[model samples]
Target: MRTLILALSALALAGSAAFADPIADRQAIMKANGKAVGAIAPMVKGEKPFDAAVVLDALKTLSEDAQKIDVAALFPEGTDKGDTEASPKIWEDMAGFQAKVEKFRADTAAAVAAAPADLDALKVEFGKVAANCGGCHETFRIKKS
Candidate 1:
């Protein structure tokens, strides 16, 4: 009974960590991404310090990195701690998720291709593309404080 109890405790701890992995990754990505994006606003007004092509290049890199995430890997077996902001319905409604993912992929790619030679051109496209992130977060992600 003591051995069985020990095993059960170990299992619970391991299980919780698996569930928390995505939350940890999400936090880390947001930290990096927030800082990266913050650099754009100021550059959007200046000429010497600003380079829309470079910004678009960075966006391409970010989009590539985003694709590396295997979202299903975040889900654990036999879990009950339901704190994940990602809707369980995401798995059930794969078509919608896939469409959103593809849209993000295309939008990011197009924005990069369409990088404006001047700040005026870049700012318009930049804000439009950036809005996609919030839409996904609102629908699929849990609010983080």
Candidate 2:
């Protein structure tokens, strides 16, 4: 019984540790979002042939990634000091930052719903999602040299 208790306690701590660093958590989610964009960017640019299934899958990934972000929890106070590219403007203008996040979520969700099958349709939907990422990065991310 004691051994089982210890094992369970260790599992709980390990699970909690995964969420201990909000910066890392948010960064991981953003990286996943980037990868989703990368997967579809070539088709959008006409460099690769449009595959409807791949486009739809990528959009779904973006939508799921956006849903994982919890702005208030991830951008909490004191997190701005870490090894993060998050700009101070995030904490200062949290409302604007949150608005951008919301826009991203909404845009990605719409893109997934539209499931653009043709290259032209993919271009339009992908453009909206990319714009949200760019706009938020411009205002809320600190560019690293």
Which predicted model would earn the best TM-score?
A: 2
Q: What Cα-based lDDT does every candidate model obtain?
A: 0.64, 0.92
Candidate 1's clash total is 1
Per-residue lDDT tens digits for candidate 2, residues 1-145, read 9999999999999999766889988999989988899999999888899999989998999999899889887999999996999999999999999899899999999999998979999999999999999999999999878
Backbone collision count in every prediction? 1, 0
Which of the numbered candidates is closest to the native, going by highest lDDT?
2
TM-score of candidate 1 against the unseen true structure: 0.61
lDDT value for candidate 1? 0.64
Residues 1-145, model 1: lDDT tens digits: 9999999999999998766766556556655656556666567656348776667766765466456445555433322145545665566666676666677677767766776677777777667656777777666666646
TM-scores of the candidates are 0.61, 0.88
Q: Lowest-scoring 10 consecutive residues by lDDT in candidate 2?
A: 16-25
